[model samples]
Target: MLDVLVIGGGPAGSTAATLLARKGFSVRLLERDKFPRFQIGESLLPYNNDLFDRLGVSDELKRGEYFPKYGAHFVTGDGRTEFTFRFDRILPPEHQRSFQVRRSEFDHLLLRNAAASGVDVREETPVTSVRLENESCFVRVASGEEIEARFVIDGSGHASLLGSRTGKKSDIASLKKIAVFAHYRGVEKPKGRDAGNTTIVVIRDGWFWLIPVTGELMSVGLVVDRDHFVNCGLSAEELLERSIAATPFVAERMKSAGRVTQVYSRKDFSYRVRDLVGKRFALIGDAAGFLDPIFSTGVYMAMKSADIAADAVEARLRKGSMRGLERYERDMTRALGRYFHFISNFYRREFLEVFLQPSNRFGLLHAIVRILAGNVFGAAGDRLKLALFFVLVRIQKRRPVIARPIRWEALPRAASL
Candidate 1:
């Protein structure tokens, strides 16, 4: 019997399998799709650098053709409010830089690294069902194969294979959102060190993300409230075009660019599971929960949870008990909760006003920058920073300030190629 069975070949599964295999566990990882397949989440947070180093992929990532992202820039729809948060300002220099990658290449690299690390990785092997027994879990694949393992890990991302089977997944009502996106060529980019900075352009009903995936290619997407997007009576492509038109800075940047892929839409953007661990199994990555992509926390959360889950699994295997599972769940919940707390109020005008036109009162801007740099899961200092940030936000909310209203009418009309 395999010591561990990891479902899905994304960052979570690959990371878990790699770590466990490195520790001499008999691990098997199954993926429904072949490698080099297209995926959307291009921007990575700086914290991922540490995880990559632990996985021994930091040098490989550096050698890849991916764009180096140093920070993020935010601009409101009207282009009047804007601010930049360079990662170096708050995070240590070693953890201040990350990358914007083409998911196809990036994921493939990680999956391949798992195989190289002794993980028995099987591609195009869809897991049809998972059954937990008293002593082990049995996984059924489309090929009619049954694999028994001491423990099972669900890293199947949004598909939530085990999560759905056990009725654990629940949608986050407040975060009913849809994302429409595509890759583009020739999109205008900033010069110098800011060239790879991810640009977030906030509109009235949604926000746009512009990430540099490579020197000559960029990834552009809009995340909008589901109700507003559905009620717009526009196709996904149309909605994307309209969203681009609404964000002046994004419009100006893309004016001379052309899309290189078909527009894609993803719904039900936010959700959580009832629990991260259960009988002989645990969930990691999107299988456990997912948050809005405003801060580009998806991949970071996924890999971070995987790292924690691997530790728990190792402990369980050695002691024949799930001792560390509770800690894994607690740590992940606290990490995600910090993000949820801030993102829940991200769409509000007051938060945007404070964010885009930040005041350094109480060292609040630095606190906010630390969060943006994915430094929320660290020691006591990070917790204090987060608390200070929330206090500042509350103060900003109590003392409302009049800010410029977004001029929707001044936006350019939507156009096609």
Candidate 2:
């Protein structure tokens, strides 16, 4: 039997497979899709830099020519308020910068790194069924090939292979939004260090994300309430265009731009699994949960979870107990909770007031910057930072606001999807 079987070749699966293989465990990773496939979530957080080093891919990534992102820029729909959160100013020097990458190239790089580290990687091998029996997992692939492993990792992303099979997947009602996105050329970009910074344009209905993946290409996406899009009756392309037109900052930047990819849409994207681990299996990455992309935490969280999960799996194999796995689940839950707390309140006026018009009083801005830098876990110092952030939120709620309320508005009659 193989020591481990990973049911995806994305960052999570590849990370876990690489780590386990490096530790001398036999790992086989099956990927449903081949590499170089189109994927979104191009923006990455600084914390990922550490993971890359741990996986020995830092130098490779540096040589890839991906856009170097040093910070993030936020602007309101009216274009009157804006601010840039420079990672260098708030994060530890070593964790001060990350990259915006084309997912195709980035994912392929990680997968290749895993193979180089002794992982048996099979592309275009979809897992058809997963059966857990005590301390062993039997996985059946689409080719009718059966594999038995000591443990299983469901890094199958939104497919949630094990989560769905066990009826553990559930939607997060509060985070009901759909994203429409595509790549474009000729979009206006900032110069100097800000050239790679991800720009967020918050409009009345939703928000737009402008991510620079390369010097000549950028990924532009709009996230809006699912109900609003359904009610608008627009096709994905039309909805994306309408959303772009709604944001002045985004519109001006894309006025002379032309799309280079087909517009795509994903709905019901926010969800969580009831459990992260079972008898001989665990879920990592999108299989565990997913939140709004407003903060660009997907890839970071996935790789982080994989890192933790790998440790837990090693411990479980050595000690022959579920304690380590349980601890991993708890740790992931707390880290994800921190992100969900901030993002769930993103559409609230009180949160926006504090986010758009930040105050340095009580070191709140520094604390927020730390969170934005993906320092959600570890150290008492981080806890203290988060505490200060919550206190500031409570204080902001008490202050009076003259701005308009944050409520969804109906699409204009001329709006087309």
RMSD of each: 2.3, 2.4
Report how far off residue 175 is in candidate 1 (Å): 0.8
Measured against the true structure, the TM-scores of the candidates, in listed sequence, are: 0.95, 0.95
lDDT of 2 at 134: 81
| Each model's lDDT | 0.86, 0.86
For 277-312, candidate 2 gives per-residue lDDT tens digits of 976999999999999999999999999999999989
Summing lDDT over every window of 10 consecutive residues in candidate 1, give the lowest-scoring window. 408-417
lDDT of 1 by residue, 1-417 (tens): 999999999999999999999999999999999998988799999888888999999998899998899999998767777899988666788878999999999999999999999999999999999999999999999999999999999999999888887888889999999899999999999998799999988777678899999999989998888887767788989989776866578889989999999999999969988778975999999899999999999998899899989999999899866668988988888888889988998877667766777766666677777778776667456576667656656666777553333444453433323
Q: In model 2, where is the ten-residue run with the lowest total lDDT?
A: 405-414
Itemize residue pairs with steric clashes in candidate 2. Answer: 235-417, 238-417, 239-417
**What are the clash counts of all predictions, listed in order?**
0, 3
